[model samples]
Target: MPSTDDLKLRIEAAIPGSSAAVTDLTGTGDHFRATVVAPEFAELSRIEQHRRVYAVFGADIGGPIHALSLVTKAEA
Candidate 1:
């Protein structure tokens, strides 16, 4: 199981100019809620921005992280 810090790193690396706040939604380490802010998300649609964030985890999304709740925003 990946730690929340690990998840935050992966997202920050994947999303341009992005930072993340991750919460463990479950004790199993398979569920999380992440608040991500990035400049790359500025022009993106909500779903598209979400997809970009989701793309970071790839297979880990459903495996090590079963559920990922994402909150994406542009860098203000």
Candidate 2:
């Protein structure tokens, strides 16, 4: 299971000039919610922004990380 800080760092690292806040939705560490703000998202649609974030995790979305809820925003 990935830690919240780990997820945050991964998201930030994967998307340059991005900030991410990750929280474990459940105590189990498998469920998470993340809010990511990035300049890269500025021109992307909501689904595409989400897809970019999801791509960072790959198979981990269904494996070690059970669920991840995302709130993404373009940097203003």
Task: Write down the TM-score of every candidate.
Answer: 0.93, 0.96
- Identify the runs in model 2 with alpha carbons over 4 angstroms from their true place: none
Off by over 4 Å in 1: none
Return the lDDT, model 2, position 60. Answer: 96
Prediction RMSDs, each to the true structure = 1.1, 0.9
Q: Write the per-residue lDDT of candidate 2 for residues 20-43, one digit (tens) a residue.
A: 999899889999999999998999
Quote the positional error of residue 67 for candidate 1 in Å. Answer: 0.3
Local accuracy of candidate 1 as per-residue lDDT tens digits, 15-53: 768999999988778889999999978899999999998
Error of 2 at 36 (Å): 0.2
lDDT of each: 0.89, 0.94
